[model samples]
Target: MSRIMVIGSLNMDIVSRVENYPLPGETIKGIKTDVNPGGKGANQAVAIARAGGNVSMVGAIGTDVFGDQLLEALQQENIETNNIIRKEGTSGLAVITVDSKGSNSIILLEGANGLLSMDDLTDILPEAIKDPANIFLLQNEVPWETTKNIIESLSASNASIYLNPAPAQHIPTEIISKLTGIFLNEIEATIITGLSVIDQESASAAAEKLIAYGVTEVIITLGEKGSLYRDFREHVYFTPGRKVNAMDTTAAGDTFIGAYLASKQQGYSIEASLEYATAAAALTVSREGAQKSIPYQEEILQFLT
Candidate 1:
């Protein structure tokens, strides 16, 4: 039985609800405010655990109240957290503003998340590299250099390494060549490939470019439209998005990635995994918050059935 090892950031999200976004220099009143446990890495880990997959988390958090709360939150979800480090500063936080339409804009403060060093990630690979069954998941919430170092280090290993390059940054083709694949949203795909991905045709073009750039596999999630997976062999799998009254879409992408990975690890076919992930994401968008919005395995099973 293999498990997923998530090595990345853990952030506390401070969210405010507004009818719509205010223009620059314009002050607006919020409908409500809520604090939620979030972070690309932490969200995916929680999603994996709730989706019934074995998962362990690794990252850095500050010695602040938010850090403690984040740790406790993950523990409550039954996610393994022994590798999370404690730093002497404020924890990472994201200031989010969600509109009544369920769209969200966010500003991130790195804080202790930037303190997650490459050395903190090295020990997990030695044993994992020897096994093809082990999966290492990464995101761009931490320092780019740390993520780059881990990807480079795994170049010679047999372990499955997948990067969810959110908060998109410039990634070299050499790095892509070493990955098992990538799972990212349309915005990330646009940033990474310098392409405008407003629909499937554009997403298809971007996926081709990523494949040309050396990524062996690619999965691009298009909100409302659907998600598509592309491999080097030119095979394609697409999953249409389920329609629902979305309350807050902040966690939908994370939920999809986690559910897809969980399904794959649980021995489902690629098409089946994408379908499960789509259903899980539909569940996520219909709710509010981050981790709290992600559906449990039983819920997803029921939804699919």
Candidate 2:
């Protein structure tokens, strides 16, 4: 099995289900509320482990009750967390609001996630990264400089680097170009490239810009519309979104990435991997919460069949 290392944020997600997202300054009554252990990194790690991959995580948590619960949840999922740094503050949190259409709006608080520094992450996983069988999956939840340092110094093994540039922020162009793989949403692509990404034409255009900056492969996720793929081999593929009765859309993209990585590690072809991941994400949207909704591999296979 492929060993995956996810280096990013861990948070407690506070979710509220509302009839519709309130307009600017408008008040709307929510149907229910729930708290779940979530964070893009944690969600992805769980997805991989549940899909039958070996996974380890590197992140920071606070010395709060939320942090304690989140760590336990990860351990229950069989994700290795020996590298998680516990700091003196509260853990990160995402205030998520889901509407009846399964659409979501999130307000994230950095909290302890923002405290991870270059020194804190450097030696924590050196032995793990030395194994050529591992893959490093990174996110933008931590400091950009810290991520850059780790990626730049990751020459100890042949492990490939996969970057998910979510919550897009200004990053150094040189650093982005070194990524072996990149995942981004349509909006994030536009923000990074200063292009309008309302259609495939724009997505393709923006992707070209990103490719010019150095990524070897790119996956642009278009919610409800499907996804587009580009690689150094000059082939482009698209998968139209599968129809489903979506209830809460939290962690859908993280689920997609996790499933995709697991499929690739299983030696499935790119087309098959994308199809499987799309199916997994479709199931994720039909449920609620983040890590709580990720279907097992068999469940996703059944959905696809």
Candidate 3:
């Protein structure tokens, strides 16, 4: 298995189920509430592990009870938590609202996630990136400076650097150039490229724009419409989404990214990797929660068959 390292945030998700989203200034009662382990980093780590990858995680959590539970959850998924730091105060959190349509809106509290510094990564990355087959996965949940530092340090390394720019932020072209692959949703693509990505054509255009900005490869995920891929070689294509009755779309994209990388590390071609990832993500949406929703490798393979 390919060695994977996820450097990002860990959060406790406070989820509320609702019939419909509340309008601005509107107050509505929630059908139910549940606290789940989440955060893009942890979610992806869990996805990678469940998809049969060797994965470790690097992030921070607080000394609070939620932090303990979140760490336990990652361990339960067979993710390595040795690199995870324990900080003072509260762990990160996400207030998520899911409607009957399985769509969701979220508000983030960075907390300890924001506290991750370049110093935190300095001692770990050199060792982590030593193996050429190792992959370093990152997200926008951590501080931009910390991410920048890691990328800069690894620019000359052989390890693959994959970035999922969720909750899109302004990233420097220099840092973008260092990435081996980038995964982003339509909205995130739009934010990064200043182009509308409502359909395949536009998504392709947006992906090309990102490639022009120096990223070696780019993938724009379009929810139920599937995803678009573009490489520095000018190879561009779209993979149609697998049709499924989505119950909760949470962690669907994370599952796709993790499974795709895992497949690639296992030597599958890009097309095959995308197919496997699509099947995995489709299964994820048919379930609920974040880590709870990610399908195992066997489940994904059976679904694909």
Candidate 4:
């Protein structure tokens, strides 16, 4: 099976459904509420496992009830959580407000996620990621410094590295250089490149900037407009998103990146993998919650056809 290692956040998500987003200082009525296991890392790990890849997670949760539930949920998805640590603080949480339009606004509290220290990472050692079978998946939810150290430790390994620079932050050019793959939205890409991405043209320009910075490949997600991808060979492709009524856009990009990695590890071609990834993301937006919305491989295959 395709083996994957993810270093990111694990969070408990509390969701509230409303008629529409409340105005500043204005209260609105909600239809329902629920709690779910989330965090971009956990979502991606579940996605990979559900898509038939072997996945492991290295992140921290708090020593709280929510953290306990998050771990249980991940175990149900068959993700390897042997390295997941529990800290003293509250687990990270995302307070999500979803409107009837399928749009969402989130308030993220980086709680125990901040406690994932270099020591915790060093404990996992080089073997976890040093082998050729490992593909490292990273995001910005946790401390980028710790991520930098991990990337540096694995720099000489034959394993591949995939980074999703979400909630984009200012990182060194060297980190960008180490990536085997990168997934970003137009806005995240713009944050890195300072490009005015009003459309595909600007998106291309932004991707070019990333390539110039040493990323081997780049994939820029453009919401409903679709996605743009470029490889080392200068071959560029655009995958148009399939339009459907969206229920909640939470975790859509995470699902896309996760499924894409899983498909690639399963030996699917670039085009086919993107198609599968797109379909997986499409299914996520049709539902609610983070991990709750990720589709199974069978569901994605059906959607593809």
Candidate 5:
């Protein structure tokens, strides 16, 4: 089986559910609020494990209670966490607000996640990344420079790598060329490519730009509408999102990514994997919380069947 290693952030997600988003200088009462163990990296690790992918977590956490809780949560998922180090200060934090429509906005505090460095990566991967089956699942929650260095370091290796650039930032085209694939939502798509992704055609145009930069594959997720896929070969595909009662969309993107990668690792075809991921994400939105809302592999299978 292919092993996926997630090098991303771990945060305590604080979420508030409001009727709608508050405008600038406006305040609104929340329907409810809760805290959950989440970080793009940690969330994806839980997702991969739950989706039946062989996964390991590599990152840093604080020495606080949240860190202890985060560690315990990963352990419960049966993910390998040997590379998750402990820093001196507070853990990462994500303050989020979800509307009744299941849409959300978030603000993040870097904290220990910012402590991740190339040295940490060197200690974790070493020579294993030379193996193509050792897939690295990364995100933008960590330092961009560190992330870039990891990609550059693997340029000489055959390792498979993918980036989910949430909270998108500028990256060099040379670095983009080294990736096996890039998965992102429409909003993130706009930030990275400087193009609008209001629909499938727009998303494709954006994907084409990345393909021209030499990334092998690009998948742009369209919330509720569906997802669009395009590769360097100009081959394109679309997968419609499943209609359901969406309660919270906090983990939808992460769940989709986790399930899709797990499905691919398990030898599912691209079409099947997209379906699996869409189903997994649809199931996640029907529930509440981040990692807690994500379904297990059997649940996705059952949901599909």
Candidate 6:
């Protein structure tokens, strides 16, 4: 199995199921509430591990009870937690609301996730980057400076760097040029490229613009519509989304990213990787919660077969 390292945030998700999204200043009743372990980084790590990859997670959590649960959850998934730092405050959190259709809106509180610094990464990353076969997965949930520092430090390493810039932020062209692949949704793509990605033509255009910024590969994920891929070589294609009754979209995108990377690490071609990832994500949406919703490799294979 290929080794995958995820450097990102760990959060306890406070989730509520509602009949419909409330309008501004409107109140709506929630059907139920559930607390789950989540965070883009943690979700992706769990997804990779569940999908049969050798995975390690690097991030910080608080000394709070939620932190302990988050740590335990990662361990239960068989992800390495040796490099996870525990601080003396509340862990990061995400308040998520999911409607009947499985669409969700989230508000994130950084907490300890914001406390991650270059100092925290200095020791863990050096050894990890030494091996060219290792893959590093990153997300914007951590402080931008921390992400930037790690990217710079690993720029010369042979390890593959895959970034999923969720809650998108402006990244320097210099740093964007160093990425091996980028996975992002339509909204994130619009934010990064300043182009409307409402249709296939526009999504394709936005992806091309990202490639022009020096990225080796760009993947624009359109929920329920599948994803678009463009490489530096000008190869462009779209993979249609799998049809499934979505119960909760939470972590769906993360599952796709993790599954795709795991497949690639196992030597699958890009097309095959995308197909596997799409199937994995489709299964995720048919369930609930974050890590709880990601499917195992066997499930994904059976679904595909």
TM-score to true structure, per model: 0.93, 0.91, 0.93, 0.93, 0.92, 0.93
lDDT of 1 by residue, 9-88 (tens): 89999999899899999999999999989999999999999888889899999999999999999999889888899999
Give lDDT tens digits, candidate 2, residues 1-305.
Answer: 66889999999999898998888999878899999999989999999887767888999999999999999999998999999999898999999888887677889998889999978865765777666778899998988877888788663354589988877876567877778888889878888888888777777777788788877888989998998888877678888889999876778999999999988988889999999999999999999678999999889888887
lDDT tens per residue, model 3, 53-129:
88999999999999999999999988999999999999999998888876788899998999999888778988887
Off by over 4 Å in 6: 18-30, 98-105
In candidate 5, what are the lDDT values of residues 110-205, reduced to their tens digit?
999999899887756775575578888899998998888888877667578899988777767888899999998988899889998888889989
lDDT of 6 by residue, 1-305 (tens): 55899999999999898999989999988999999999999999999988888899999999999999999999999899999998789999999888887678888999899999999877898889767889999999999999988887887775689899987887778888889888989888888889999867889999898899888999998999999999999988899999998877879999999999888888889999999999999999999678899999999999999
**Candidate 1 weakest lDDT stretch, 10 residues:** 121-130
Q: List the residue pairs that clash in candidate 4.
A: none
After superposition, candidate 2 runs with Cα above 4 Å error: 17-31, 97-105, 155-158
Give lDDT per model, in order: 0.89, 0.86, 0.90, 0.86, 0.89, 0.91
> Candidate 1 local accuracy as lDDT?
0.89
Q: lDDT score, residue 211, model 2? A: 82
Off by over 4 Å in 5: 16-33, 97-105
Clashes of each: 0, 0, 0, 0, 0, 0
Error of 1 at 290 (Å): 0.8
Worst 10 contiguous positions by lDDT, candidate 4: 122-131
Q: Which ten contiguous residues of candidate 6 have the minimum total lDDT?
A: 151-160
Error at 78, model 4, angstroms: 0.7
lDDT for 216 in candidate 6 is: 90
lDDT of 2: 0.86
